[model samples]
Target: MLMLRLVIASMASSSLSFQEKYDVFLSFRGEDTRNTFASYLYAALSAKQILTFMDHELERGDEISPTLRRAIEESKISAIIFSENYASSTWCLDELVQILECKKTREHIVIPIFYGIDPSVVRKQKGSYGVSFAELEERFRDRMEKVHQWRAALTEASNLCGLDSKDFRPENKLVQKILEDISFKLPKYLSFNEQLKGHLIGIEKHIKEIESRLSISTKDVRIIGIWGMGGTGKTTLASVVFQRLSYFQFEGYYFLWNVREEYSRYGANHLRKKLLSELLNDESILRMDTPFVASPFINDKLRRKKVLIVLDDVDSSTQLEALVEGYYHFALGSRIIVTTRNAQVLKKVADDIYKLDGLNEIESLKLLNLYAFGKSSPPKNYAMLSNNVISYADGNPLALKVLGSFLHSKSTDEWESALNKLKRIPNKDILDVLRISYEGLDKGEQNLFLDIACLINQSFTRDDAEKMLDAGDSFTKIGLTVLIEKSLIECRKDNKLWMHDLLRQVGHTIVCDEHREPGKRSRLWDVKDVCHVLERNMGTAAVEGISFNMSEISKDIKMCHASFSEMYNLRFLKIYCDNIDNKKFKLYLPQG
Candidate 1:
């Protein structure tokens, strides 16, 4: 157990190290396992957002190159795939030597995967290894020391605990087990670049201000609430701060994204379990699931370990109460951050409230110019246009981003048309600013955008979306790319589609304004709205889609033939009930 703790500690230490270039360096014989086992392992690691180094180029000459050796030294863990012909390669043996050398000198971990081969054969230099070494000794009889070093490396690496492909029938299971063990060693980190969209335009000041409010020098527990309207960069600031502080003195860190949505869908118990599991680096906490009910007590372990927790897009105080109980029992030096559109959610719990407003005139201009021209200031010809757009953005970071990106590389005439349309939106609300971008989309893109916004949750997988939209190949081309290009949406890891919270709200608001009556809207998602439309048989031909959960309604209403008679244009629908016993459908079909 002591050695186990030490191993885990070493993993965490290596993971957080700034100098390591990769999570795992994959060393394998290209002729044998590169296409089969090595490819599977590399793909699994990449899917988990693990930075892995795999040499794809063919092995050229006798020994490993300087670049490959450096990769082995730079990686936190070296995963060696020992296949049937692995020892036959002079290059693989040289890589193994460098990998084991790093293991002895640095805080590095070595994982050996014996693929379709016995570890005893590797450790004792028998069978295929013996044949290869006999040939190698004959070829390099003058430099026998190199052969001895190669033998020692293989023997040492084979003794380490690793996955054996034969132990698990159906090789994918072994691949999954290896992935899990690798994850167990490293701390899970959310990539800031993946979330930030790579444009650090006007967020620096917010970062510094929040850092000051955190009072990191003090020993007291701190809860900083960043309250603002949508598209004001609340999530961005929290993410930046979380990334910066995660490497510091904190015992653990967890950033919970889309808090309100998660709470509504999974309940507070889910949040509690997720937080505990993340901070403890143990998924077993999730196995301790109780009844889906609220509770004030988190684990007692949190009281002794200082941690950093960021709850993004929180809408309710109850979510916090159920997760950490307002950090009442937290350890000293722990920091909690809550980003919410509703300030009331954090009012009772936060130590200091940082109300995020719009960027100032200078910051806004710089941000717009940065996105527009790839510099802090625009070209000489576009100064007035730049100023006009930034002033119209009214300091909202989202607006600045979308507008600048939208206007990039366009002709001056196109710029005038774009700015003219933006200026025509009288009120200049952030929503109005966002609407201008939405207005630029064609009819197909617009319909798909609205469908995505009104029908889906904050995050959804591509497969589910493709089925609903019947948008196999063209869905991405017509809608997803356009929205992403305009900075209205993003495709993150795992093919999950996510849009800014404000953009979703804009889509909802637009659908609501399609008609004051719910039945006239193109899509229906809300329980009350769907019920209002269906129960009264108020369905209209205008209703193109409906996503309803019958479990959300307290009582059942008979859905009959008339329920769909009017909805001739209802091409998409998703109506589900949580309880198996609640399924009911009464259709009055025409006589066949």
Candidate 2:
């Protein structure tokens, strides 16, 4: 029994050490190329103890072996080494397909090693992979459909630009370069994940102000409002306060997102249920029907309890009224944090309101430099261009992130072209900054953005999208592959793709602008234009067969339509139509 226990302990230690060290999962067919270039990479990475999982294929089976699938899924990163005749074997093709799917579902980083194969050849499924696939189709003539999916996955994988296995050198310079790239990316990934943790932005000064307001003897339900342009970090600041103060006098905390939308859509019951579930830590609010029924329950639970509640993105006083109902129900020391884009809304809830200004010029430059060139200080040669990019970004965090990621890899000419485009584009509202990310995409990726904007829901899967759009031939054309590369779209565990709300708005605006009338301003929810377009086309059935196409418009043509109505026909349109009244729709199209 003691010997068995020792063996189990030894196994556990080995597993933990293996996880702690490895950074990349290298998937290669041993017969194809692993003995040479891939073997060198494995040795180099392992020497640094940057853990790599290389399946040398000592074992093979008819079905995908369980060990290979687990390694593909579990690894933090997967690099495929595709050589000539790599896709010929069913074994290699299956692994390649699984890796592509894994890219969607998991945070499995994939870097392809194109060994003696062209990227375009991979994308279009020409040359070796295509020839191999053709022969397989003949062999499995009755099972052609199953074979076709494998073809699609192979073509998609080949299309992506991976480090060429031929790019390897015995001098160790290239391997060293690859290691440097991996190291540089690791910190950036960590920083982004940290930013996504949801804290209050620009709240350090506000913390002092809050401190000044508090006194020794008694306390009141202090309402402090943090107001700024959307995405200016108002909610983030309130979150910071909530995290810090909740442990102090506050016994309860509720962090609500999109408070205005929640109240308007679900009404008071939504607020009540959210508060109850959060405080009670239950999935449901038992013994409660209406919000009023649960009010006393909330008041009773929070009576003597000092609660710190953050109501994020509260656009109106109605949301305030629905939430606290006057603040008297809480204990004396309880505090409520309200965040908004409107200063007027702030005045209603806040004993004190803060107007969040843009970051100062120096800070703005610092932020921009960090993003654009991946350095805190601009390089001597690019000082002029660096300053220009920063000046244009306007100290907005969203703008900085957009410009930084877009220009990170481009040359001086690319940066200059981007700057010229920005000049033509008018200064945008906070959400519009994300549109710059779309402009940065290649034309194919822009099409993918259009499809995602018009079609994908919060949890829509890419498999369904590929199937619905018949994306077999044009997967590369749509830029879904590039979108993943740029981190514009994230894949969830269920194989569904998700985008940030800001990114969705950017894509939506791009499509709308492109499709707008030559000289008309695009009002996103314009009822008349919507009804007119639908009626003009004689509804969904008329436009059903025609594929929607949009061309870039000139800057002088400013008043462009930028949104659409959803139709069974114009599947591209996805907007809330309920906001338009029947009278307004009639007014938009008055006729016999």
Candidate 3:
């Protein structure tokens, strides 16, 4: 066990140590290439938000400075532009030697761009390159060892695969090509597994199914959809497939996350421009005035490039049209994956759809144990409690994780109390995620959802709930259908209406948000709040409904006319008193 702990610590430290400070480093002769080609390249990279280090001033020395060396060591990639006078300066040669050394030592990426210079001349040390080296040899005759190292460095760098400026016609075209190459070579900045909170229980099977659906080896466009409720891990699954399939064989790749939220916040035009800019590797596309203007540009530019794109959390079909119209908008062999909570959105554009379901009981327990104990199974002493928590979570990944984390270090008694509390009040983090689908409902649907969440869940059938709600039978039926489609509620084969515990808590909380005081709230479910309102005569017009289980309360309670008089809009009230004969509970009414 001690050795296992040490191994885990070491692995974590190693992961942290591998972080790169800069995305790219620029190596060029300031006098020869800085003002023209180098400047343009730096500006383009900076506009794309690529972290780069470029020395703007000229360095006057034969040896590379410590600061420059550090930059080379910290950068993930280095771009060496070999101009006419590149080899003439000992400073440039020394920088090149350091970059190549870092490449050999750290497995860094080195891109050599022969700008208006012959690759053969640079590789063989002939022509202008030879002339510059001769001058360096004469000047550094005493340091002949250093001059030899510089010559070897240039030869090695020039031999690697690189771009030649002469092959690309216009300067802008050359810049675009370089950007595209960099995009292809750059490592993924975001890790899909990391976003999953380090738990991927039961994900491998889904990934394999998605991989078979992709059929990436075929030379045809494929659009696959992943649909599920919130917290179902749809985004995580799609991200894993994307990262695994996106290889250097593809021309380009882009992942656009939170399409629904971002589109709502920044509008469809912003998303369209961002998509074009990222896939095309050019930030200038962001200047387009509207999505209509940008669509043609995207079609013209990306139609020939085979790429992989993932659009996550899409809520509408319009977002799909604006980003990727259809097969005609992309090159053959391209693949597009869209993740959404609505199946209707996928029916319009997706050729294949994969619907995600909740985790199984065994997987749920494993996930909870991993979060609480950092292992695959709970400790022997806590096995029963773990099972109980899993039962309450009902295979929901988010709830299991939240509850496990909350009860991680608590004592046995605390665990019992926490579980009891969870039966009444849900964890805030869990409620937040479950509330997203609830917030998306219309007012009528929202009311119907609250009725199920607060009073009807697991106890009442669909017909019973419809009879209780004030909306007409047709409107109530439509609302219930919408709720079911959105995964907010489920109807069992027995015709009983059911809701996830976390979602039920969210619905109750929404009604609670009307006011902090119990009497001012639209709904009341907690015994303490109900007792306070009834005992203190705090009932008010805001109290629309009240539901409580009297058996859970130990003391007897009595309510007079004042408790019911102030509630002018009281619509429904339910009290489950199993010990009514033992406890003296009374409700008095006023004369009409």
Best by TM-score: 3
Candidate 2 root-mean-square deviation in Å: 26.8
Give the per-residue lDDT of model 2 (tens digit) for 1-592: 9999999999877654443124577766677767786888788777644668887644777557887777776666667777777767777778877888877854456777676677666667788878988888887899888688887887777666567645666536656656655554443333344333212223356555654553312577777777654445666556555544453234566788778668878787668677757755666574466444545665676676776778877766667867777467777777777876645565655777766555666766666676666556777767899788666655556666666777887888888888887654533554453454465566767766666664566556877666655435766424565565344565678888877544665655654565445113222233444444544532333221112111111111112222122233433333333344543333222222
Give me the runs in candidate 3 sitting further than 4 Å from their true place: 1-198, 215-222, 248-250, 289-301, 403-425, 531-537, 550-557, 561-563, 575-592
Candidate 3 per-residue C-alpha lDDT over 1-592 given as tens digits, one digit per residue, 9 for 90 to 100: 9999999999887754765689899999888888899999999889766789998764567678998988988888899999999998888888899899888866678999999999999999999998988888899899899989988998999999999999999888888877767765663223322423435687778888998998978888889998877787888798877766664446778899999889989987788778768878888888766444645756777788898899998877888877785556678889999998777677877889998888898899888887888777788989999999988888888788788888888788898899898876778888777788877778888887887777664777888877877444478877887887677887789998888776787888788787889899877888888888987889999888888887777666667767788998888788776657643555433435
Q: 56 in model 3: Cα distance from truth in Å?
A: 30
* TM-score of each model, in listed order: 0.45, 0.41, 0.62
Better model by TM-score: candidate 1 vs candidate 3: 3
Instruction: Estimate every model's Cα lDDT from 0 to 1.
Output: 0.77, 0.61, 0.81
Task: Please report how far candidate 2 places residue 326 from its true position, in Å.
Answer: 4.5
| lDDT winner between candidates 1 and 3 | 3
Q: Model 1 over residues 228-291: C-alpha lDDT tens digits?
A: 6567788888987886666444778889998877988988887887887788677876887465
- Better TM-score candidate (2, 3): 3
Q: Decide which is better by TM-score, 1 or 2.
A: 1
